[model samples]
Target: MVKHLIDEQINLNLLTPEKTLFTGEVSMVVIPAEEGELGVLPKHAPFATTLRAGEVKIYHNDNVSDVFTISGGFAEIVNNKCEIVADGILL
Candidate 1:
């Protein structure tokens, strides 16, 4: 199958003590970094930042997405992969 830009994904891994929230690919993600809102995509430059209590938007497609309220955490991106070890998360 062919992939559209919205379907052009990057690897993602989200973890918490209770369980692994997500592990796979996503089109894009918006994180609430402490400095400001961060928009991440595939092949993005290596990034690491602190997060604040806010919304985390995981975009799956043009018309589909998942949002979560994060209490706090750290986000890091490297080699087309994004990992988030959340302090606390609310679906």
Candidate 2:
């Protein structure tokens, strides 16, 4: 089976206790970690971090595709996937 470009991207999911905010395949994601802004890409090393209240930036094709305002959260990165469980999201 041949893999396409989109299929090779990172899978991102942003969620809150009430609902899931976003879910898609993106090229890159910039998360607001407690330490600092952390950037995650395809094949990124597996890790997890706590997030502070800040903006979460999502990128596709090297451009800003979407942005979300999160009020603190936790992020987990594994197997080319990023799952974020936010305390709250300002929609």
Highest TM-score model number: 2
TM-scores vs. true structure, each candidate: 0.85, 0.89
Candidate 1 lDDT trough over 10 residues, lowest sum? 1-10
> What count of clashes does model 2 give?
0
lDDT of 1 by residue, 36-83 (tens): 899887778999998898888887765436777888899999999999
TM-score of 1: 0.85
The pairs that clash in candidate 1 are none
Per-candidate RMSD vs. true structure?
3.2, 4.2
Give the top-scoring candidate (lDDT). 2
